[model samples]
Target: MSGAFFNSEGISALLQQFDVSKLVELSKKVDLLQVIKNLNSMDDQQLAGLMKVLNAKPKNRELPEIDGDFYDVSHTLTPEQRELQLKVRHFMETEIKPIVNEYWLKDEFPFQIIPKFRELNICGVTYDGYGCPNLPFLMEGVLAMEMARIDSSIATFFGVQSGLSMGSIYICGSEEQKQKWLPQMQKLEKIGAFGLTEPEVGSGAAGGLTTTCKKTDDGWILNGQKKWIGNATFADLIIIWARDLDDNEVKGFIVEKDNPGFAVEKIHGKMALRIVQNGLITLTDCFVTEENRLQNANSFKDTAKVLQMTRAGVAWMATGCARGAYESALDYTRTRKQFGKPIASFQMIQGHLVEMLSNLTAMQTMVFRLSEMQDEGILKDEHASLAKVFCTMRTRDIVSRAREVMGGNGILLEHDVARFVADSEAIYSYEGTKEINSLIVGRSITGFSAFV
Candidate 1:
């Protein structure tokens, strides 16, 4: 019976034979008992050796620590903030990084990631009420930076949902709209997309929007094609912006994916942000009820307010892209050997590393303060535009330097830095181009309207 029981469950049954409490007591004195028994028989050397063994403390483990920012911007964070930042980063690396490249290669969004993303529960982070965390905007910026650090495409995908889409509804949508969407969207039960740019209207979208909406007795009839709409392919709802034909002012609509006239085709073979499922959206006489129309979005001015809010987040995202490239390059240089020494030891290589770090640190500090202004209600369009232009422009330089240091390995997608290098171009163009952003700042400082 004992043998049979042991075969089925070895130690569990045997545990009944011994008094665990007594055994634990015996274990505490075993060394002393042996020492007393052997004291008379052993030499001084033997006693000393035994004493050393019994008193020895465990050695501290030396695990390889990951330092993405060599200057340690993490040190600037509060202990709690840093903890949250690390939590999000680990989630991204473990959950998102492994599958991102495969999806990028196939140009397919991973449906599997939705559950993992929901577990994060970070949507509408800085907003109050409506199932939001209401964390500081700095934390929001940190989260964005952390996401982009691993993969910019994922970051952009999230920005479209959280910043552009949800923000529009939050800032402009009616209280009823907020009650209907923000909570479910916050939980990611329904994904959202922002549609602003058109196929022909690239940089001058504000003045050059060709998409138009006509009001009717029934509702509103929308006619337009929206280009480069991230997440539109799978999004449950898209915030479509179009000029009102009667008023000639921009208005926003909650366009459902299942609408009769709505169509989407994936834009493929992109050199940048390919993991993002950008779609060319076509809405021919798409009927949107007045209830679905955003109540507060009266003109281009209302639309611009939402853009102003999200532009700061985009700047932080650009900084994240630069930080990712710099860290990858730093790690490669430190580990990769040349002539039996680490390439990081070379003076020229050191110069590149320093340059990357300088730009990254500048970006980090700038975004930190920018988010602070946003939280304080002091942020302006110029404040957001300056960071966007500076960070994106610097990110291009940082990623290029990162790739150059890796030699041929830089071009290989497996190295991870190459994707960032490519994705920075899209970041540079989207959410207002570098030229457009610079002009925004230029207009603020000189009090001159340069945007044509």
Candidate 2:
């Protein structure tokens, strides 16, 4: 054998494969010369097997996917529904994800995405006719979660259109009103906004809506201000709810955006869901013909139906917000090194991750059942309210932990968790607050109204 066979490179490679103590022990062996002779005489196959173990890089134990759907609640979805869920997820990730942060920072709606929404063909998903797919309410809930999982602002925008605006028309509009508005809204040709939350009325809207409408010789004249009206600035239609002056009951009107009596100021300096383009609308005797009135929305109770149907969707949106934050924080912990190892390998980090997953799993299971109830025609006010109260509260916690795990980087928008964290606060306060929703459940369960 040539002396070059045992040169410095060979020795250096051999040292990497063994501990120094083992190498020293082998070096001191009396039969070390015999060991070299044995190596020279070995068969090629034997030497190849011996060299393979020493030369190969350490194999990494593969990690499972960091999916927030830990309990597989979505597994119950039909194959078609699952495919559609993934389709929406892909659209948000590819199209909206790139521009969401920019629009969010600019406090402006991405008008460009509205045309793309037409391509998705999913607006007005739950309504039966007038170009709607009339899919199960469960499908609607899943789609909401899927959209929110990417960006809550987009999800809120969608909920306003599909749930509040379209739902009011679907559940309360006369047949003629439905035929007029739904098909175009379904195609995203006309964006819509729900105007129930007045400047002075939110939870009190059920009884104390100051926005009033009076029967007129010409038409109903609506006068009031609506605050936090999402999509109002650019929406083609705004569904305005006002107290009837003659009857003292709540009624709905489909107000056109360009009405001479209707004006909206874009709300600025918001810290969360900034891309939603929330507006404060002033209606100075906004006149609508009797035909534009939602004929069946006779009182607050009918308007409550619209709210009941949409509040469940808010719970699903909360879950998506939490899911986004949790997944981002989890992936971050797995890759981020601290104290010479991945932070995810630490016990405390794993503990936070598990807690987040546990809360998220609970929220998902609750909404899954909640949607089933809606599809079965059994969903009630307290039923939706309870889920909203619990899920939104837990979402706040989940996002907090998500930010906690990410430390400083969690607050930055590029990491995505910060956006979820900020958007979640809006979800918690909207539709109904924790206190108001709790009172709804409290009134239902104990036969007592705690709401003041």
Name the top lDDT candidate: 2
For candidate 2, write residues 179-226 as lDDT tens digits: 989998899888899999988788899889999999998889999999
The TM-score values for the models, in the order shown, are 0.85, 0.88
How well is each residue in 390-442 modelled by candidate 1, as lDDT tens digits?
Answer: 99999999999999999999998888899999999999989999888899999
lDDT of each: 0.88, 0.91
Model 1 clash pairs are none
Model 2 scores what on Cα lDDT? 0.91
Error of 2 at 40 (Å): 26
What alpha-carbon RMSD in Å does predicted model 1 have with respect to the real structure? 13.7
